[model samples]
Target: MADVSANPRADREENPLERQRELMELLSQETRHSIVQALLGHPKLLASSAELNHFVPSKSKKTVEEQLEVLVDAGIFALYEYPPNEDRRGLPWKFYGLTEYGADVLGDFNYLEGVPMARAVHRKTRKPEQIERHEAAPRPPLPESVRATFRLDEETD
Candidate 1:
């Protein structure tokens, strides 16, 4: 569980950056990360627990349910109950979707698109030095014909 400050004034003062950091921490958990990615990727499409099981097949249902509750409590996920018109059973199964705030939060992190500078780190593989070297290297000159087509040759003249 994340630590909550008892002092309201103190909490207010510290919340701006801390809020984003807290969200990042929540997303850093692999299961939670996967859940968020799946939800965001699909937008408003509601996903049932059974459908979501595909994302974290290795985890027990209890664990996944608990995590879903955590996300719901955090306001990152919206839970939907089926309409009462249908003759459903006593216990209503819920479907999950990203809340508006959830979509904004995930968008802020560029979670759907690949991370800009972090793409080099794949599957826990870190090659910071290589990434730095790649960035520092200059691009090769464009072919003259291609450049001429774009009127770059006139710019030089």
Candidate 2:
């Protein structure tokens, strides 16, 4: 009943790009995709929920939270929490980083890092006030993995 010329694959039982199509569909959502991009561009490859939220300040925090949950469920992200011993008298500090698979997938978009401010690495292109706010934001100690990756070790006395 369908026109074969107009819909050649309509009757096909299998699609060669099914997996990639599914992944694309999942990442098609702007916010979801942006979250991944932000992480991939980060110098330490990690950020807190609060810090990440700043990148999309217009969106409701709950939206970011839910998207993060979805990414974690999809195995694209790993949540890192600050140990209680170093707790800062508030809610547990939550940081996020990509899984190995996530990094591999992100490699497919290496060209995206050429945007303004060079993939959001330096905030110099941002409004001066915005930069001020970001600088003033609380920077909880980065996880040890990030420290080692960025080589921020303390000198032994």
Model 2: per-residue Cα lDDT over 1-157, one tens digit each: 1111132223343773765566576676788877776665554556667656776666788999899887776655677555552465443355676654454444444423443343455343253454334334344454464355334465231
Give the range of the ten consecutive residues with the poorest summed lDDT in model 1. Answer: 1-10
Top TM-score model: 2
Off by over 4 Å in 2: 1-16, 84-86, 90-92, 109-122, 125-157
lDDT per residue, candidate 1, 1-157, as tens digits? 2112122223446577887778889878878876665444321234556545554667777777888878877766667555541354332245675555555566678774643222233214333553323222323333343233233445421
Give me the candidate number with maximum lDDT: 2
Q: How well does each candidate superpose onto the true structure, as a TM-score?
A: 0.56, 0.61
As a whole number from 0 to 100, the lDDT of residue 118 in candidate 1 is 29
Backbone clashes counted, model 2: 0
